[model samples]
Target: MFGAHLDGVSAGPGINDNGSGSATLLENALVLAQRNPTMTKRVRFAWWTDEEQGLNGSDFYVRSLSATQKSYIKGYYNFDMVASTNGGYFINRITSTTAAPLKAYWDSLNLQPEENVEGQGRSDDYSFQQAGIPTSGYAMGAGARKTTAQATKWGGTANSSYDPCYHRACDTTSNINATGLNRSADGVAYAIWNLAVAATPVPDDFSMAVSPASGSVQQGQSTTTTVSTAITNGSAQSVALSATGAPSGVTVTFTPASVQSGQSSTATLSVGSTATPGTYQITIVGTGVVTRTTTYTLTVTGTGGCNGGQLIVNGGFENGTSPWTGTTGAIGSPAGQTPHSGTRFAWLSGNGSSSTETLNQTVTIPAGCTSVTLRYWLHIDTAETTQVTQYDKFTVKVNNTVLTTLSNLNAAAGYVERSLNLGSYAGQQITLTFTGTEDYSLQTSFVLDDVTIQAG
Candidate 1:
């Protein structure tokens, strides 16, 4: 490809025309050979001795190959005139799909390149493409004037030949641009790495686990829980999640409805106050290439109607003081006041003096009862308007030991209902007491209504 002294012409150096391609190709082959690369496909390099004389060596080599031997080639790429002086980046406008990697290298540099105008069918790759093999190549321009558009895209003097001494005697070491040679060498190396490497596809698969999978909810409250997802036997993927078979008035929501593989997310299950009382089984499913399901149990309690259903005697006080014993203060059923439920409710009043009033009830614990629940609606109003400390107070007790305290300072807005788990005293007879005490100056009233006790 260099100085072979062609017929009827003086012997001269051809370093800028085909010499740059031959040298770059040889360097690439030598580097790969030095590394002893373990490649998926075999890479073969050819140096055509007479490309200057109309591609005689490459044409003879292709004609000698059998059809089976030719079919082994997936693609053919040529590099010619790659380091011309004042080189303008150029890529072959290939008619086949093998041009993607060649185009990608220029695109990654954000460089706008022109097509291979000077070295189209005039190189050794033309023989491969004529045999229906996919072809792609790279070339720095040769003997062509750089237009104004090329100057704007590649930043060079316009209307001047890319290589002023192409195919001349002086096209020697001085004819090469060091920066262009380095960039063109890097591009050729990238093409070899992109095309000769084997790729393995990843399979999509995952699993899910909901921690504390079983839980309880009050008839009208919400709960938040966590679920974790893990990718199994695959690369990262997005998994869509959903819930099925939830009870009435119970809504389930996932914070991130979709999650990346091998990562965990949270799902909040909100049970409305009017939700039906029962045990519900909900299945949470995550869908991707494969579907996975996890089951969660939700138990709802305290739907009222406990007198004939085996627990409370007068929960709503509709029977009017039949089962409760009042002691030590003015405590009675008040009429025409706001009640949480039913017409009458019990009220304990401390009219402007420090006094304590209490209501007691003795309930026999049913045998084999593993858990007990106490729920009631409460209201407190007081004239004690102080921030640092509380004066008028109300409390609940079991056997005269304080269980929980309530006051005007901490009471819910407008008689909200609350629940208590008395599972520790499941098999013992217990005295449940509701007490209210007022300080010396301000009068505060404590009201209780719509109470229920259940054993399960």
Candidate 2:
């Protein structure tokens, strides 16, 4: 799906804020209709209204979808302010599969696009994201000032707001950057063509292969390869893609997750810092009417030494609670409490009533390590006035064995570092857990962040 807001603010003409995006979408739709190419997947174009009123239009559309209906949508692409006089090329959710085609289109033009941090959670795409649908888009930038690096790359004045007339009366057709608009429009078409239409007509059957079938990566690094498909015998059909046989400390993800036969997708292999160094075969399976398989050889080179081996995955809670499981709202970046380091942390037992919240992840301590240590930063805050009462309690445990315990009595103003020597548990798989238990009166919050299990 491709979408843009049709409504604008009450300020000026609001041409540059969204006129550029809407015009681009219309032009692409016209061209696509004229060409009338054979499409493997359905393409949707949405021009939403009331976007200025807190994304009400897009939010309502998403809220109206059933689970099965939502699942049918492969991805969503949004275009908001794609043409600013001093704007720089930016891609929303740049790391996602939905952004792959847009990024590739920009990269082909040597545009050196950046992630659109300034517009995140401030646009219509946020609506689709909340519905768990993959979304990505383009932007020329908005109220943010262009930095010197951006100016040098995209050729604009440094420290100037990308859109000086944003949401203002002066925003009109004259404010649109023709060059930026042209590039953004072309990128939108490029993504749509790559995602929906096939390059060449073929039969119903499809053939699959991976480009650069073998690659090498170092620990703590990542690499990507393209998975291509071509129609062989039958008509185009959806091919669901998945990867398996990855070793521990390694993760495999596909951008589109699934694609119509004859469309290609990007497969990314991320190697954790502590991944065992070796060669491995990763199988990419595409299941459509029939299952087709391809293999990619991955060689993992070690970074060397124990200091480079951190066993914990997403210990800092930066990756949104993957590999760790517990309560629904246990891990997040809530407004009241700040994390020890990153924007997210494990927050437990702030409910103020009788409650228990637990967060845990399982990892193996490598056999040959001479020393192993666990470290985390903790911040405790409480509404309890009494200093001596241990009303709310927090505990750290390894393999269900208590390592240490603290209470509201230990509450302090800021974060404190806690460390434990785990040499005794070396060469064993263990579950590290943090549990918070609150009593019936005052609320005590136990926040943990920047966790790591290092072995030497």
Candidate 3:
């Protein structure tokens, strides 16, 4: 803005010459200050003290600022001689990205704004622009004549100075064009609001998730699952995929292993038949500008009673109790009075008073087995007068659950064949145990020959 004084001229009120620009700028500042608006950048308004003496006021202002202070100014916009009697809209010819908003504002109103071809470096904005700050402004014509084209567009008199009052005393209240001043004020507000405000930056980030996060697979087989990634904010970047905590014999791979942000990728998990049978937790990770993790659960089945034929390791005592564990009195396959399927049989004879003997074996029931049967030939001879009460006994168990108990008092004929239904324990791993006990009275004996478990 310029409030210059002409020492030699008598009618140098200078209202139209600079007062219009000064008033509009002050009004814009007042409205914004009253609202106490928050903006990313600071805005300051200035009114130059002299212009007729060669831009002295603006020159002195620029020279007073420090180099760091000057650099802080991003842009400068001058409003001088904006409202003229024959006013025509004009925008400063600023050749930079900052010029976009002003140009766009005019375009939005369907107004054809011209460049300041007449008064390029004749304003206060020139001072800041010279110090490397981006500068732009709007001006109604001064002493320059408006062309026929300008008259047609702005509805003004052609071939006449835009402001006839120029720097004369007549450049007072009567010299102002209300419509032109209002429109120019609006243009100033538009540029200030858009250019002075700072924009917030969005963070570059993404999220990850997996479908069917947990699953189960049978031994000797492989299973597959997927992992996906999605962008949350900012520009696209490559994201790499990986997996951890896979058990032995298991392999995990990602397809198109890396994907651009805002996009997704896939991962597959495979387990070999020889993979260990147990539960596992697998971690799937996505890494790039950002990182994320997810977990998956997988269970592998163990070998059991799936294959046909006898399931026990050594069904008959003819193998000398190779697969069975014995814990107590007189447990061995000694030459017996009778043999069930071989020349030798298992015998559990009382070792002393109040003593017990236990023999057990663990077996796996394979997959697809519906029913199981355990059959054996046994003999018991005890001196006890009563069954469990006198304490000379024999007992059988499956997986820690007692199945039967007997004593010689109720013993069967010399040698008896017994069978047990193991249908409920199908398709599982189980332990089978046999126990024999004797009281202080006398010794007792429990014998077994062929012991077989069959599954279908």
Estimate the TM-score for candidate 1: 0.37
Over the full model, what C-alpha lDDT does candidate 2 score relative to the true structure? Answer: 0.82
Residue-wise C-alpha lDDT for candidate 1, range 325-428, written one tens digit per residue: 87623334445357777777778764779787788888865544445778888887777777657788889898988988877686444787878877677567
Per-candidate Cα lDDT values, in order, are 0.69, 0.82, 0.69
Identify the candidate with maximal TM-score: 2
Q: Please state the error at residue 425 of candidate 2 in Å.
A: 87
For every candidate in turn, the CA RMSD to the true structure comes to: 21.2, 23.1, 26.2
lDDT: which candidate is best?
Answer: 2
Model 3, position 340: C-alpha lDDT score: 63
Tens-digit per-residue lDDT, 1-456, candidate 2: 556442222112222233223344334444654553567888887877787789998999999999998999889888888878889999998988889989987887778899999999988999999999999998888889999999999888899999888888888777877777777767776678778876564445688999989877778999999999988765788999999899899998999999999999999999998877656789999999878889998867666423225689998888877989877477888889998887898888988999999988899876655557789999999999996878899998999999999999889999999999887876788999899999998899998999988775
TM-score of each: 0.37, 0.40, 0.37
Clash count list over all predictions:
1, 11, 7
- Cα lDDT tens digits, model 3, 1-456, are 212221212222222223223344334444554453446567887667676677788788888889988888777776677668787877777445655566665555556788877768887767777777777776787889999988898787999998888877788777876666665656566667666643443457778888888776665666666677676655567888888898898888888788886666666667677766556788988888878788987765544424434677666666656778887223344554456666776677544477777888899865665547888888876655564464677888998788987776655547788889886886688999988877776767787767877664
Assess the local accuracy of residue 347 in candidate 1 as a C-alpha lDDT between 0 and 100: 80
How does candidate 2 fare on TM-score? 0.40
